[model samples]
Target: MPLVALVVAALAIGFEQLIQWKYGPMGIIAFIALTIGLKAKNTAISGLGAIILVMLLAQSN
Candidate 1:
């Protein structure tokens, strides 16, 4: 269980780093908004963040 958790954490960190490298501060901001919105149980904010992230990723490719 602990090893699984560790692997998940590591993968998450790596993805965050990849986003940071590819998209810079806007990526971080969108991620934070998504996380906070989810934690707060607000669909509107989370949706906005998700949209921003999707747009950013789409824009790149």
Candidate 2:
């Protein structure tokens, strides 16, 4: 259930980026939701990693 939400949130972020939408802090919230849903230390860490990767790419412009 939570993993599903996480994926949805991630996809949403991706779409927003595709359309050049600017959302401040929403990505952090999504990452938090994903971490909680993951319920594993390693998963949470990886989720953060993925979020950072996305954020970096988003800010590259």
By TM-score, the best candidate is: 1
Clashes of each: 0, 0
Error of 1 at 46 (Å): 0.9
List the RMSD of every prediction in angstroms: 1.3, 9.0
Off by over 4 Å in 2: 21-61
* Model 1 lDDT, full chain set: 0.90
Itemize residue pairs with steric clashes in candidate 2: none
Give stretches of model 1 more than 4 Å off: none
User: Top lDDT: which candidate number?
Assistant: 1
How far in Å is the alpha carbon of 27 misplaced in model 1? 0.8
Model 2, TM vs. native: 0.34
> C-alpha displacement of 43 in model 1, angstroms?
0.5
Q: Please estimate how well model 2 matches the true structure, expressed as its whole-model Cα lDDT.
A: 0.63
Model 1 residue 33 lDDT score: 85
